[model samples]
Target: MEDGKLTVRAVERALDILLCFTDSSDLSLTEIASRVSLHKSTVHRLLASLEGKGFVIRDASSDKYRLGFRIWELSANMTHSDDPALILLPEMERLRDQLDETISLYVSDGLERVRVQAVQSNQAIRRVAPIGARMPLHVGASSKILVAFAEPEVQQSLLASPAWPAGLDKASFRQQLAEAKSLGFATSVEEREPGAAAVAVPILNRAHRLVAALAVSGPSNRLTLEKMMEHAPVLMEAARRMGKMIK
Candidate 1:
């Protein structure tokens, strides 16, 4: 019984270490030790174990630890289970058919947004994002909408992080978020990926908290700014329908 208890405690401690990476991308041994209230030696040992398991990787130059691909693999697996992707697939397909452009569903994961599901556009020239693609939250319309409607704490946290957009200051970013909220959707043109334009709306839960973002993307030449605005109502309505269905 003591052995079992020790194992459980160890698991909890490891989880604590992993959770630390959610807010900060990299950490030194001392930083992690202070964050988890563990001795430096203990933290070092835990990090070693996690490293062996491919959960963390250390930078050779900085010696700071960052989350590894294993975490991304596990996260991708979770996106398949108990996620709204399945429920949103039909809607995505319908939206794709309507616009003849790509439709994707994105959810926030730490400081990034993951494309959980997507229906590619049938058009000869269109935007296409793979199902498991992960991208910075400050880059695209889908990600920005997710950030805009997120909890105030999350918004503030992201705004203050180094991952925040380099071109936009905190005040400007906040204003953009406010504008997205006021407009009920977000739009981007050649922001993240050149030649791609997108319009997105937040999918909210019954409590009106953001659950995900639904976006329509296509070639900028075809999906011009005017076209994006024209499709905003359709995307917003689809988002609302998804919110209701998921709730």
Candidate 2:
């Protein structure tokens, strides 16, 4: 092969090794070599290069390789420019029109969640969450949904901080998050703002990682607990559709 083609082949082989770990957390050298259809020595060289770059790590006890923290670091940087609001705006509009309630998209930002986009309700009385508004992750439905589906490390860090919402201890907050994850959605009534209620569902990427939260909010009188539950399916369906559109 030409020099350029040889370089491309090498890159492809390296990527093939990385992809092998997707279905399983850890793999032995022989397993990787077989999966990639490469010689054991070639696989060893590629694995060493990947380990040096912090893309994979070997377990000293088991002699198996697994993804390294650098993969998450790269994913974090990707999120910086990933604005799911652009993809979710149309779905938000559809939800707003269907329910005549305010629809908002929120993404995790440290211990807080930021409202990236919103479609307002035409009703005379409705909850209005301004775009760019930041709220505590432990409070509103949208914020809590973002927190509930956050990476385990991120979730633990946020829960340990003083940013935990008032009136709920760490244990209680953890239970709530567990419940949210179990139900595949979250609800809030006067948690963030008096007389405001909301229900939110997580928008996940193809990897099943949280990308954003889709929520509908309105006055407590209009969005009572029962009403919110009734509308939960709509919000979840919209979230599912949004997830497919986002990267």
Candidate 1 runs further than 4 Å off: 1-82
* Model 2 per-residue lDDT tens digits across residues 49-165: 999999999999999999998989986766444567766777788889999999998888888888889999999987877776778877778877888888898788887887565
In terms of lDDT, model 1 sits at: 0.88
What is the per-residue lDDT of model 1 for residues 192-247, given as tens digits with 9 covering 90 to 100? 87888999999997778788999999989999999999999999998888888775
Q: Which residue pairs in model 1 clash with each other? A: none
Query: Each candidate's TM vs. the true structure?
Result: 0.68, 0.66
On lDDT, the leading prediction is 1
Task: Tell me the spans in candidate 2 whose CA falls farther than 4 Å from its real position.
Answer: 1-82, 165-167
Output the TM-score of candidate 2.
0.66
lDDT scores in order: 0.88, 0.87
